[model samples]
Target: MSSAFGATEKSTRQVSTLRRFLRYVRPYRKQVPIALLCVLIGAASQAVGPFFIGWSIDNLIAQGNLQGLLLALLALTTIYVLGIQAIREQIVRVGWIVQHVLAQLRQDIFTKVQSLPLSYFDRSEAGDLMSRLLNDVSTVNQAFGQTIAQMLGNLFSLIGIIIAMLSINLQLGLVSNFVVPLMILTTALFSRWARSRFRVTRKTIGELSTKLEEDIGSVREAQAFNRVQLNIDEFDQLNAANRDANIEAVAITAAFLPSIDFLNTLATAGVLAYGGYLAVSGQATVGVVTAFLIYVQQFFRPIQILSQFYTQAQSALAGLERIFSLLDEPSQLNDAPNAIEMPPIQGEVKFQNVAFGYTPNQRVLNQVNLLAKPGQTIALVGATGAGKSTIINLILRFYDVTEGAVLIDGIDVRSVTQASLRRQIGIVLQDTVLFSGTVAENIAFGRPDATHAEIESAAQIANVHELITTLPKGYSTYLGERGAMLSQGQRQLISIARAVLIQPRILILDEATSSIDTRTEALVQDAIARLLQNRTSFVIAHRLSTVTQADQVLVVQGGQIVEHGTHQELLDQQGIYANLYALQLGSTTPVNTAP
Candidate 1:
């Protein structure tokens, strides 16, 4: 009894939430009215059949009228077939419109996800986002497609049946209605508890999905580290939690259903007893009593439907909450009102006294300044986490500097459109990402309209044309996701080729050759030379060989440029760059004068 009492209290809260959830359906009011009209017609057909039977029993049989009986049977058959067809057509059409509306909603969600900045991704969990995109959207789809129409239609049917029953005989109708309010009150109370349990189930399912994705993606790592059992245990725990939540939700519904069924039986018993008394007293006709019985049955059919709708609506409410939450999230960053398209760039890059951090009070770059004149190649060398990548990110406007300015062509980068800025720059990163497509497709990703000849030329300049030809399909070979079908060195070469194919005014090489063998690196040196010619470039690498080729080398320490000069000039100074050079060279060599 205590457990049942607690369940009732919890169910009350769920009913309130479900009521709030219905607000999302307000925009579809016009279609809803037509659909309801169809439902009402269908429900009216149910009561119509009972009247025909009553007429046959009380009049047709007494008069021995064979023609009237045949006509009534034919009419009943026609109404059943035609009404069912009409109802089906309306239901299917409503479903089609709802599906179309859902597609637009899904596209809106995906667009919002893409438009958000990097910081949003940095702070958000991949699994949580996936839940909203996949699970939540699906939940809402089911809700809109089925629940909304049924809820309103069942409600109207229930009301119509009650009115028809009273018109037949008021005392019997009143007796049948006695248990309805009780059933409704019980359901209203239990629904709140059921919804909370369902919400827990939904949340658990999302966590499980996220964990499964992570585990599969890192199966090798898990096995190698002997953590597979640990992961399995965690998954089992989540699965168990999800199971309990679902069972609890099912239990609430199961218990309430039996109580409602008992109440309905009690109503039917009262109608039978009272109608029989009225019949004996000659106060009501036997035909009227018979029709009233059918009406009572019809009345409860919609009640049962309403009970099921309550369960479905609860699940939909949970989905709506998650969907709205995702839509409510603020974008990582937005353009200023005065932001304008950047002018044609000459690729003169400047960072003046820049300070930045991924989060507040944790500086990554502090008081950092650098300059690259048009057609100059600057190399930045540092230990890991010395802010080399942060500088590149700032330059590309993947992130903005916390203080000061990043200027391109003497204009502040923040003052211009990021898309315009990026179109003029090309990047090759250490972890090369290639989409699943032919070599030509990957090379043309940055410039989708590039000619076939242009793609071959870029591959040739990158010195990978010969290797690509060696493959069975040459440039047409389909690379797997992230170019997993190719070797790391081969993927890096493709990335470099892609960058060169873009032919941007500015190029960024952030350890572009870090994954390749020395032979391939040496072979690609000329390609790098051709790629850098007359283009402003920032190259981040620890390899002394690559650093020495730069017009200027900047040795960054603790987010500041501690030393800056040509290779020989820096070696003469015997500072951070010289020490780093000697460390890689294994022995210090005499500094040679610049050419």
Candidate 2:
């Protein structure tokens, strides 16, 4: 009873998956009926082909009626021509519907992922997501585009053939169907046996794809660390697993496919033996027996096609499951219904008893309180994971505060739409990211409408103007993937240019000058000094020297501000800030980041 219930549950899940797939199909439903109509027309044409042949055999051949035989032959040929045209139309219509659904699915996946909070990406794998978008989607395309259309046409043909056979000779048609139950039982057993193997094949494919993406993305690290052999061994292990899974899946198919053909042969033999006896006994005409043979062939052909389609459906359903799973991920950053756009800023920022955590019931920041007046520079000095970054995150509203409010000019950050809140802020991080675009394009990323002259001016302020102009094609030079053509400091320079072009009321620099050498740092720092004028700024740094000149310095330790004041005031207090500065002065290297 449990086994039966398990089978029923599996069957129910499959039905549910197909129904979900059809929801995507519903938008293109107009095209579906056209394809189905074509299938029915094609089935009708095929159903009568055998009848025409029997008519020609009985009247024209037996009686030697040449003119009647010619007419029957011509009619049969015309019906066949129409059948072929209808089948062609079915394929064309179904193709359009599948392509459109796939396109919409891809678009929705991309838009959904982009809207989701960073927390989702922090736990997800990029390679797996890419596999779903590219490899899995392609699998669905093949099954929907061809296998579904063929399966539909075969179903219609099977029904039409069964009806046509019974109309001509009842007893013979009944006998020809004797082997059908056995065929169905064989199909069910083999399909059940192969189902697990097919699942393994899909899982292995996803793993292999993820491994490949991981290797390619980190090829530089692999080479640098001299772990090429280790990588190869790891990849080979995954590759071998994938190979074994596919082989096992194909082995199931290899065993099952021929058994279906064997059943078909048995059915055909039964028809021939029974029909021959009927013909010899004068219970049926030779032509009638011949027609029954054709009908029997048509009936079994659908059974065979259905078995093949089952395998394709398994693959397509797996793909659909993954695609829908991505779509179901909530955009945790969505704006509230009553969210208002933030107005231009006066740059005052206040954190009131703020508390936060990446996970529930675990606080990363606790009882944090601070205030920065307009145009003031606030520096956060701490060791790695001291909640300095988390403080910045709260101000940006990347994640909402748990205990209190983070406000800009007395307006809670969460009360404003995220787009409007982020627009008036400029940030430059230590690790810069540049897209595949020209030099000018990267500079004007924050302000797309900025003209070429404005881009050049920003680049000049960032001290990267001469460097970009010297590159081939100047502003029009295409940067390859992630700006691979540029050096590290150069990319940092471009990022600074982007932040500079925005003219934001507030500025954030997260170790922004860390990548540049001493010479470039002097130039970039001067430009940054100019940019910071009349703007509220937050600077996070590991090196104590970086924050020494700030208007106010807050020393963070263990998710709380251990000390707060000007650099000299904190030193006079002889607390954590003073001790850290004394230690930094004694040590040769800067403090490190969180692991």
Candidate 3:
């Protein structure tokens, strides 16, 4: 009983998946019936050819009648012409529909990818996502364009031949159909096995692709660590698995086709033997016997083609399952139904008794509360993983607080659309990221419509205008992937320039100058100071000296604020903040301790 329930449940899920896939074809509904009609007409035309040949041999040739022969020949020519025309029409119409469907599917997949939360990317492989978008979509396209029409046409042809044969000679027709049940049984069993194997092949291919993408992206690290052989061995294992999966699928197909052909051959022999006997005993006319022989062969031809289509359909369905699985991933973050556009304000941000975690059991921030008034510079200093970044993430609503609220200007951050909220905030990270584009484009990324004068002015404010002007093409100079052509400091300068161009009401410099040399750090720090002018700013830095001038310095420890005061006040207390400051500045003098 349990097994039966499981099987029923599995079948129901498959039906649901199929129904979802058919929704993509809903828009092309009008064209579909027309395409199927063309297929049916083409099959009928093809089925008539064998009967005409038989008629010519028996009624015309056997009678030695010139008029009958001439008439039969003309009829045969007309049938061939109609059959070719129908087949051509079917191909043209189905091809257009398949291309249109693929385009729509790809567009939808891309849109879904963009709408998904950043957390989705954190846990998923880029290559696997790409495989679903490109490789799997192409597989479905092949099945729709080629296999669908062929399968329908073959079904119609099989039916037409069976009917024509029975009308001509019932005994021969019965003999011709003896192996069809066996063919059906063989196909059903083989297709089940093939579908399972093809699914494995597709999964293995995705895994292999994921491995390749990971290895290629980190090839430099592998070389630096002298782990080239290790990576190669790992790649070989994945490659071997992909090969074995493909071989298993191919083996099933290899065995399936010939089995159908053998059954067809057996059916043909049975028809010829029975028809010949009937003809000899004068129970059937020569033309009837002749037509049965031709019709029997024609009947099994479609069965063979249909078997092939079934195999292709299995592969295509496997691909469709993966593609749809990707599309079905729920967006973890979505705007509220009545979410309002964030209004420009003084940027007075506050975290009110907020508690949060990336997962349910592992709380990363606990009852955190803080406030940043308009135009105030708040510096967060903490050991790594001490919830410094989590505060920033909450402010940006990258992840919502599990309890309590994060408010900006007395309004809940979640109450506003993410785009409008983020648009008003500017961030420059420790690791600078720039797309492949002109120097001007990277700086104008946030405000694409900024004029050349505004772009140059922003660059000048970031102290990178002279450097950019020295490049080969000045503002038009191309930056390669992630701005590989520029030094680390240069990239950071451009990032600051980008933030300045936005003219944001809130600014976050997350270890923005930590990795630069003293000279570059001075320039970046000066630029950051200018950018923070009259805007609420949060500075996360390891260097205590950077925060000495901040309006308020927060020393975070174990996801809680251990000390909070102005820089000199915290140092005067000689607590965690003083120790960190003393260590960084190499101060060893004993100081008075205060609570």
Q: Pick the candidate with the highest TM-score.
A: 2
lDDT of 3 by residue, 440-473 (tens): 9999999999999999999999999999989999
TM-scores, in order shown? 0.89, 0.95, 0.94
Ranking by lDDT: 3, 2, 1
Model 1 per-residue lDDT tens digits across residues 140-162: 77776776566555676677777
Candidate 2: pairs in clash? none
The order of the candidates by TM-score, greatest first, is 2, 3, 1
- The stretch of ten residues in a row with the least summed lDDT in candidate 3 is 586-595
**What is the lDDT, from 0 to 100, of the residue 394 in candidate 2?**
87
Error of 1 at 547 (Å): 1.9
Please give the TM-score that candidate 1 achieves against the real structure. 0.89
Comparison by TM-score, 1 against 3, better one: 3
Question: For model 2, how big is the CA root-mean-square deviation?
Answer: 2.9
lDDT of 2 by residue, 370-489 (tens): 999999999998889989999998898888888999999999998899999999999988888999888888889999999888999998888889898899999899988789999877
For model 1, give the 10-residue run with minimal summed lDDT: 586-595
Give the Å shift of residue 455 in candidate 1: 2.1
| Model 3 misplacement above 4 A | 1-10, 586-595
